[model samples]
Target: MATISSTWRVFLLIILSLCPITLSATVVEDLKNLHPPPHFNSTILSNCLKNPSLRYCSSSPMMDFDEIFKFTIVASHLCNESKNPTCVETFPNVDLKNRPNIAPLYLSFDFFWKYCPLSIMSIDLSNNSMKGGFPTDVLYCTQIQSLDLSINAFSGDLPIQSFSPLTNLTFLNLSYNFFSEIKLSDSQFFKRFNSSSFLHSGALLDEKKFTLKAVILLVGFPILVILVVVCWVWLCFQRPDFLPRKLQRTRRFTPAILKAATAGFSNNNLVGMSDVVHIYKGILRDGTEVKIEMYWDDIPRDSYRRFVEECKVLSRLHHKNLVRVLGWCRSRKFRAIITEWTEEENVEMWLSRSGPSWNHRLKVLKGVVECMRYLQEEWPEVNYELKTNTILLSDYMEPLISRFKVGDQTSNRKKIYRFGVFLLEMIQNKKGQEEFDRSYGEFIKYITTLDPADLHKMIDHRMEVTETNFHQVKQVLSLGFMCIDQSNNERPSLATIFNIIARAYKVSLVLPSTNHRIFHGERFKGHMPVQIK
Candidate 1:
């Protein structure tokens, strides 16, 4: 009887082991629980769509496009349903019919560079869970005709070389990636309007045509609008103006002075921007270096006033971790803002280097947090436009936040909504503005109020899984999540954030997490900036 009972127990155990296990939720449900993450794969289209709020570390095969007629998920794997109605917006189905011989390719943002460098034709990486930059090496796939990389976490300038190689690319929509510009090197600039491929559609139009239309409007608009602006300017110059100016009088530069500083508007001074204004390196007579940036549009004129206001606010902010706005210049044909120049380089360029180590990332993060604390406390209505490029390493690897402009205090709730945006970029290891802004919007709506651990998932994956490192840093990321709550009432006050950071992270909490970290078995060596050592 005892033997029979033991045998029955064994049989029950076998039965239990053979039974299928049930899962309460999948990654999609997991993502939905947090700050509204980005709509990946168009949610309506690509199966590989990555979370806008998080930078998924790697990419994998998605479902076949033909499989969308059934459920979207296939065997717990991602598959594309090419026949879906929504795909018409990005890639016209015509490309699929024309390229019949081109077999389906798996283009992951991480591993695609190694396995499929350039042969991929008619591939769609759109709205998928891709992290990292536009695979410049994919440019080698000179045959790729239709490429849709929209709404993923691709950061940095899409290599001019990468796009330059795709002579056959008819449908190139990089929308929603953290790309700043489609630079026009003398060899590349597509003139055809049908190229339909771009960051913002406005960038793709013939500049000359757009300028003609803009001039026609400007020249066509009634002079009364100009008169009102002139009157507004006169009132601004007067000691007592109608609106109370929050500005404490400081040294201001005129437009001519700025032109002289920039060598008479030379193209040599044109820096770059992934989202904000372009920066130029300027040298004064005494040989002092001043960083100069011009807001792109000057014709509308109201933009100039807004820039002036932004500069005034920045001038008042005095912080070691924040860039110091020296002043701004307003000229009839030109406008410019001046600030402190750094030799340490922007985060993007540094990361592009052979050695922007994880140590550097951590060091930069500490400086960024310091700047954040200052902005939350010292600056009023501060907008944390935290991008990899905006976070500059000072001579000592201290991250200095550049480009402060004043925004409406009443709009702080909307502005703070960008905090989730910053967290999104950090998670994806993306370093551009567009992705930052989209994710910002996503978090404001969906992710900010979720339980903090859900928010923690947005931390950069490059960091190792250590208690004091990635884990605790994620706890701090939750604080960022708190600060960006849509309801200002729901947001954590700066004091509360400070107290929380103080408790969760030690004085030595920050450690770099850039590509420069060299792994040696279990240990990693940190690399300093070229300017440093």
Candidate 2:
């Protein structure tokens, strides 16, 4: 019977292999086969994309899948992936009577972003087997009215960046599953809640935020017990000898180098894509290419540390999927890092370009995981943002990340959480706004299967997981979760975390598997369905 089971699994694998080679083709073609929707051309949404401030398309008459996709990709607008928590079988039912009325997977996400990019008020994707977290740049979506993504496999923080845009948010819920540390403070958003708003079932008493072993050690473990006690009292109650020193070093910058790099800040060479910071393309006299960023003053010194740490961290880790970091500089006027130029494109662009092949995606996943294990460390006060959009690429088809710091003081802890969310986006490549309404249904379906490259499939399709190192992919994702646990202690140390990920299935520690079949309740309750299918 055991042999028969193995044989059956093999047989099913052969058939599943032929399920739909449609992973190929433009999203347009992918959709046609998935739902056979009417075909529309790319030219439809060009006008609106050029002027995003105009909210026309959000209320535009509905069109076919292809037309919507073209606009979505062009406008760089957000979209919804799925809304229904319950997986209703639309097949053969009257609800599916109008095939034209039914939206394809890609189109559903596309239109959802267009119509209500910020209209999504409350999102509770708790307890679902959803693989990833908030997409990058979603944190700035101010339209979110409220959100509740507690207790799911969703590792990471409240996505403060997403919260940036969601200033109007009245209630935000992020309680469990690898969300290790949350910083509460006296700010408008910070003062909104108490520690109770963000903890899980068995959290430590009086511990508002979870700290890692390394953090405790770095911050206290190194000192003797007596010293530690004195330090804690001295540092917490009053300033100590360790009070941050004000360093007034002579920061250097070659204005000429920056000018040439950014092409004099030409709109075309406007590399920094957002209003938050200025990005430029710079060329050194030796013809070495660099990307330089400029952030406004008064941000805070902690932000500078994050920038340096990102450079410091990425410099050590080298892998094909991991982006290369050459060097960084800290000037009084500007803090910037220099890296290899990728005139080619980013992973997001590659996803749109060839929709990375499955084999390549698996390779990408492996590279990313390996890189994460080697380079990633938990830094509560370090600088950086770790989200899907931040994961950039080069022209040569390699996956990398943007300079990992955000100018925010919360950037460090947030960056750690960002990586967890990054994994979530790779598993479901939908735009940010669309994810708010659509991620639930898509997540349940995505997680149930034990397919090894289950992760690679959702990444930019230009790559492929054809190589099939199921254990490798599984282990990496498992590690991704360990780094993202709600309790910092639950979230493994970078060394221990990577060690476990390097040998997860083989050697087990306390980290939740994040595997659906195992169903260890690695997360909270709402995401679990009342009746499991």
* TM-score of every candidate: 0.39, 0.34
lDDT string for model 1 (352-412, tens) is 5534433445455555666776776677576756676677777876767875556645354
TM-score of 1: 0.39
Give the Å shift of residue 4 in candidate 2. Answer: 99
What lDDT would candidate 1 get against the real structure? 0.50
Q: What are the per-residue Cα lDDT tens digits for candidate 2 across 388-433?
A: 4556665554556554442345533444455555554554445432
Best by TM-score: 1
Superpose all Cα atoms of candidate 1 onto the true structure and report the RMSD in Å to 1 decimal.
39.6
> Which stretches in model 1 have alpha-carbon errors above 4 Å?
1-250, 254-256, 272-279, 295-310, 343-345, 348-366, 376-378, 381-384, 410-417, 427-461, 467-471, 484-489, 502-533
Clashes of 1: 37
Model 2 compared with the native: what TM-score?
Answer: 0.34
